[model samples]
Each structure stands twice: as C-alpha cells, then as structure tokens.
Target: MKTMVQIVDYAERGQSLYIQLAVTDGETEKRISGEVRFLGELLYGELVHDKKSPLSEQARMDTIAYLKAHFGR
Candidate 1:
C-alpha cells in the first residue's frame, strides 16, 4: 500500500456490536455497511443484498463452497 491519510477510532459496550469502517486515499472514501454478530468470538463475512437479490440460497452456498476450495478456510 502507498502512503495515505488514515482515520480510526473504536468503542465497545452494551449487548451489541457496533462498528464503523472505511478506507481511502484521503480524497475518496469507499465504505460498506457491515453487521457484527457474536462479537469477540468470530468475524463472519457477508455478501450485500437489497430487498431483492437474484441469487438463490443454493447458489449462494455453492459460491461460498467454491471460494473455500480455492482459498484457505
């Protein structure tokens, strides 16, 4: 990674996991919405979807399986 301006802060308490994340080259900030579950135990991943997502449940499962096959699990 090249030199870039950065900003980071955090807070933890209560019964929920609330996090804010972002990455940038100082001019543009590309941020994605994320939800953390069972904090302190694991950090799971998710694919974004609107109220309507074309991919079926099985399609999603197969795609994840393929990723695990090529990448480390």
Candidate 2:
C-alpha cells in the first residue's frame, strides 16, 4: 500500500495541523482526516474515517510516518 498526506488546516503557527491521509493499494483507496500535534520531536494524533470507524494499525502507522517525514522538524 502507498500512502499520501495533505494539510487541510493549521493552527497555532504549527502547533497543530489538520491533514487528510490517503492510502491506495492497487485499485482500492481509502482516506481519512485527523489532527496532529507537533511539539518539538513528538508527533501524535487520531485518525478516523468519515463514518467514525477506527483506522487499521498499518494505516495509522503509515500516515504518521508520512507526516513525520514531510512535516516534522
């Protein structure tokens, strides 16, 4: 599976950011939105589907890795 992330909104000058996470595997794709807090080197957040279902562990980890790689400082 391949994952991509897009920033939808930001608050507090980078203290927090809202993002859309998209994952694609072959012909299937899934998307979710979540808020992430960036405090120094710590990054954490919760991702939920449109129907409020919890994301799979792999999806969550992939999203976090993408965010950290692109957005972390």
Candidate 3:
C-alpha cells in the first residue's frame, strides 16, 4: 500500500526538532496524527502499530532539503 505524508506543524525544543504529520495509506485513512524528532543526521519518529507509512523517510528528506535551501545546511 502506498502512503502519503503531510506536515501539519513543527516545534523546536532544546536540541530536538519535532514535526507533526497527517499520514494515510491511501485507504482506510485515520487521523493517526503523530510527531517526529530530528537531531543532526539522525531522526526518530512514531508510527501507529500496523499503520505503516513513509513518515520517517519523507520527514528526513524534506527536512534536509528545507535546511539546505533555507538554512544552507
């Protein structure tokens, strides 16, 4: 099943960058809203059991692009 990820919002706390996402499996969609944490090149994310989506992958890639374009990381 394919997944879609949408960034809802984000926040920064100390050394951690957090993001909230609305994810769906293209069918039987659930709010299943969750957050992810980014630290340097490492990223940690929460996923609902059996609700697998490409949240971590997209978040990492997108965040990297964001940093490179905006912050020149």
lDDT of each: 0.33, 0.56, 0.54
User: What are the clash counts of all predictions, listed in order?
Assistant: 0, 0, 0
Off by over 4 Å in 2: 11-28, 48-53
Residues 1-73 of candidate 1 have per-residue lDDT tens digits of 2212122433456543333322222222333333322244333345213223233444334433433342223
* Deviation in Å, model 2, residue 53 alpha carbon: 8.5
By TM-score, the better pick of 1 and 2 is 2
Q: Give the TM-score of candidate 1.
A: 0.29
Model 3 clashing-pair count: 0
Per-residue lDDT of model 2, residues 12-72, tens digit only: 4555554444443222355655566666666655563323435565556665677678876
Q: Is candidate 1 or candidate 3 better by lDDT?
A: 3
Residue pairs clashing, model 3: none
Which lDDT value does model 2 have at 70? 80
lDDT of 2 at 14: 54
Instruction: lDDT for model 1, please.
Output: 0.33
Pairs of colliding residues, candidate 1: none
User: When superposed on Cα atoms, how far off is each prediction in RMSD?
Assistant: 10.3, 4.7, 5.9
